[model samples]
Target: MLRGPRRPLWLCLCLCLLLLLLLPGAPGHRGDAGPRNKKAGSGRPWPAFQGLQERLRAAGALSRRYWALFSCRVWPENCEEDEEALAGTLGLKSDLSVRLHGQHLAGELILRTVRGYLELPRPDKALVLSFHGWSGTGKNFVARMLAENLYRDGLRSDCVKVFIATFHFPHPKFVDLYKERLTGQIRETQERCRQTLFIFDEAEKLHPELLEALRPHLGRQAPENYKAQSLRTIFLFLSNLGSNIINEEVLNLLKAGWLREEITLEHLEPRLQAQIVESTDSAFGHSCLVKENLIDFFVPFLPLEYRHVRLCARDAFLSQELLYTEEALDEIAKMMVYVPKEEQLFSSQGCKSISQRINYFLP
Candidate 1:
C-alpha cells in the first residue's frame, strides 16, 4: 500500500520549486532575489513601506530648507543681505580711528553719518556724502574703508558702483549718452539690490547734465511715495574742489593753538559749502545738487601733519612685513615736501605715496 501512489513527474517538479521559493536562504528563494524582485512579483510595495519612503523624502527636503535659513548665520559669506556688514559700526570706527591718521573731522562725521543713515527705518532719499580735500588727503582712503566695512566684496561688490568723471564721462559732447547710461545703471542696480553704493570720483569734473540727471534720485520724495518706492542707496562725491579753503581753515585753527580734536563740522562745513557755491570752474559748484540742497554732508578732510606721515609710514612697513627704524620713518616723512615754507606745517601729499615709500628700506 505504501508504494501504490506515484505522483506525475511534472507535478513533483512543481511542488519542489514551490518549497524552494518559500524557504529563506534557500536557492531560488524570494530573500535571495531581493526586495525589488519581491515587489515586482507582487506588483507594488507594501502600503506601509511606501508611506515610509515618502516620509523620508519629505524629511530630506525639510532639512535642506532649514539649512538654507541658518547657513548665513554660520558663514557670513553666504548671507543674502548685507545688513550685518552695514551694522558693523565698531569695526568701521576702529579702522578709521587707527588707520586714518590726520582727519579727525572726517573720521567722526563719516562714522556718524553712515551709522545714522543705516539706522533709519525708511529714508526719503539716498544718502549723499560730499568729500572735499587736498590731493593726498584721506578722501579715497575713507571711501575704500566704507566699502570694505559695508560690503563683503568691498569695491568689487555687485551692489557698489564707482564712476570717475574723466575716466567714465570723458567728453562733454557725450553728456546725454552718459546721462542715459548712468540712469539705467542706477535703476538696474537698485532693482537688483536694496542697499547700493555709487561713488563719483573727481566729482568736480562731473558734467552739469549728469548732476541734474542724478537730482531726482538724490532728492527727498514725499513720505507716501517714498515708502512705496524706497531704495537704500548711498552716493559718495569725492572732489578736490574746496581743498584750498579746507587747508587754510585747518592751518589757521592749528596756529591759534586749537587742538585737532577741538575742530568740528561747525568750523568747516559753512565755509566749504560757500566756497563750492561761489566757484564756477567746476560743474559741482553750480549744479542743482548744491543749489537744491540735495548733497547731505560736505565732509572736509584736513591736511595731514608730520606725525601723521610718520604713522602712515609705520603702517605701510607693518603691512609689508618690513622692518623699519624710527629714523627710517622720519626719512620717509621728510621725502614728502611740506607747504607754507616758513611754517612747513603740513605734508603736501598726505599718505598717498606711503606704500611706495617703504620700498627704499627693503634689502
Candidate 2:
C-alpha cells in the first residue's frame, strides 16, 4: 500500500516540474529568450531607449537654467561692462549716433546716467528712466542699447526682464491680481542680481494700479532692508503718452525756422508731463509717477524724419549684405506715409518699416 501511494506522489511531482519548465518565466527563457523576444520586433536598439530616458532625466535633475537662475552665473562674460567695451558697444555697434536724431539730450542724458549708475560702488537710488515718445522713435532701441552696453546679450539677457502691458497685464478688471504677480516677479528677479533691468513697454496702456505697484521698486528711498536691492535695479518705462504733443512741438519749431537743435529738454518735458496727466486714458492721467517725482529721467524720443528713414534703409540693406544705389533707397523711403500734410517729406512713422520695405526694392 505504501509503494502504490509513493508512486502517485512522485508522478505528480514530475508533472509539476514539467509545467514550470514550459511556463513564460522558465529558467532559460529569462535574459535572452523571454525579454529579447518581446523587444526583438522593435527597430530601435536598446541603447537608444536608455539614452532617451537619460536625456529626460538630465533635462530635469541637472537643468542648467534652474541652477542659472539661482547662481551668479546669471551674468555671463561680465568683462563687457568695462569702460572700453561700453564705449565700443554704444558708439559703433548700434547706430545710436545716426539713428537717434533731434534727441541729443535724451541720448547724452541716458549714457551719462547709466554709466554713472554702473560706476557706483553702491548706488543710493535705482536708475528709473521713463521714455516718452511716439512709436518708432527709438525708445525700445535705447532700452536695448542700455542692456547691450551693460551685458553681452543686449535685451535678450536673463538679467533683463521686459514686460509689455498688453502681454503681461491686459485686463483692467483683474488689475489687482496682475499687480501682485508683477510685484512678486520684480522682487524675485531683483533678488538674483543688483544690476537687474526691468523694462515696461506700452506703459501708457498699463493700468494705473499696476504701475503703482512698482512704485516701491522705483523709490529713491527704498525700505531699510531693501535699500541695497532697490539701488541695483533699473526700471525703464517706454510709453506713447505724449507722442502726439511731441510731434506737434517739433513741427512748430521747424515751421518757425527754429533750429532742430534749439529744441531742448526744458521746452519739451513740461509739455509732455502736462499732456501725460491730461491724457484721455484715466490710467495715464492719474499716474502716481507723474504726481510724485519718482522717475529719474523723462527721456523723449523725437519723431524720425525722411533722412532717418533713409539711414534705416541703408542699414537694413547693409545688414542683409546687399549694396543698393541711392535712387533705390530713396524709392523705399518715398513708399512710407508721412504726416503734417504740408511737410509730407518727413516720415511720421519713423524708420520702423523701412527694413521690410527695402526688401521690395532689393534684387
Candidate 3:
C-alpha cells in the first residue's frame, strides 16, 4: 500500500516492438513469406444430384422400350428376346450382373478419370476430347469401355457434365479445317462446361500442326478461374510410329525450305513415290506404329516378342475359326520369334545372339 504500483505496460510494449523489428514476420503472418495459403472451404462443392444416373438408367430403359416398339412394329418375331437381352446388357434391373471385359486397363483408367473430372461441378468449362486413328470411329469399343467405366463410377450422364467428343483425321485436306473447327468446338464446349478433360484415343491420327495447336491444352494446365480444376486430359496414340518419322519430316522441311513440314508418310519414307493412302495400305506393315510414333515401344510387363505373338494369335483367331486353347497359345507363343531387319536393329552385334536380340516374335 505504501509503495507505488510498478506497472510493466511500457516494458511490454517496448519488448513487443523489439520483437517485431527482430522477427522475420509475426507468427502465422505471411508478410515477406511467399504466397499465402488461401484455404478453400472443404467438402464436395458440386451438385449432389442423382438425377443424372436416374436419367441415364431411364434413357437406357427407354431405348430398350424403343427397340421393343420398333421391333414389334416392324418384325415382331424376336422383339421380346431382343428386349430382354438389351435389358440385361444395359443393367436395367438393380441386380443385373453386367460384366465388361477390357483389353487395356490403362485406356480404361484414362477414360474413367476424364469422366470423373467431367462429373465435377460446372463441367462446361472442361472437356474430354478423344481422337481416333485410321478405320476407327469416335465410338470405338475401347472408347466405350472408358465410358462404361465412368458410368459405373457414378458419373451419371445428366449430372455435372462435360462433353466427351471423338474426332478423326483420315485426310490431309481437312487437317487445317478440322483443327480450326475442333479448336472452336473445344472453346465453345469450355464456355459451356467451364472445365474439360480432353482425351485423344488415337492421337497419332491428328496432323502434326493440329497436334501442335492442341499441345498446350493437352497437359494439366488450366486456362483461368479454374486453377483448382485439374484437367486430367490424355492423348493415347495407339500407333506404331516413332521419332524416326518425326526426324524424317524435319529433314524434309529443312531441305524443302518449308516453314513447317506436315508429318506424313511422304515425308517419312521419301524413297517411296506413292500416295499416303498407298503407303499405309500394307496389312502386315507397322502402319499403326509408324503413324503413332510407337517406335521403341515396349511393354514392360511382357516381352515385345511375346506381345507380338499374342497379337498374332489374336489376329489369327479373329480372321479364322481357329480355337486358341491355352495350351495351343502357349505352344505357338514358344515357337514365335522376333527377327529384326538390318536397318531396324540398333547394332549388328545386338542381333547376333538370340538372347541379345530384341524379339517381336513369341518363340
Which candidate gets the maximum lDDT versus the true structure? 1
Model 3 ranges with Cα > 4 A deviation: 1-148, 151-167, 188-205, 219-232, 243-303, 307-324, 330-337, 341-363
Q: Which of the two, 1 or 3, has more TM-score? A: 1
Q: Give all candidate RMSDs, comma-separated.
A: 25.5, 23.8, 26.0
Residue 190's C-alpha lDDT in candidate 2?
73
Query: For residues 1-363, what per-residue lDDT tens digits would candidate 2 score against the true structure?
Result: 000111233444544454454446666332221112123225434432322322232232213212322222224454332332223233322234544554676877787787676667666667888898878778887887667655546677667889998998888899888988988888777776546888999988888788788777776653576654734677899998888888888788888887777788887888888888888775855777777877887887888777667666766775575655567667877888888787784576777777788778756
CA lDDT of each candidate? 0.76, 0.65, 0.34
lDDT of 2: 0.65
* Model 3 Cα lDDT, one tens digit per residue, 1-363: 001122244543443443443335545322331111222222214323212232333344434434434444456575543232232232222111111111132233333444354344433232333222222111233344333332333223221222222346567777787778767765554454322223344343445566555534443344474554333222333322232333343444545765331333334343321223243532212333334432222110111233334333433443343333334434444553432342231111111122211132324
- Backbone Cα, N, C clashes tallied per candidate: 0, 0, 29
Model 2 bad stretches (over 4 Å): 1-95, 99-102, 227-231
Q: List TM-scores for all candidates, in order.
A: 0.76, 0.72, 0.31
RMSD of 1: 25.5
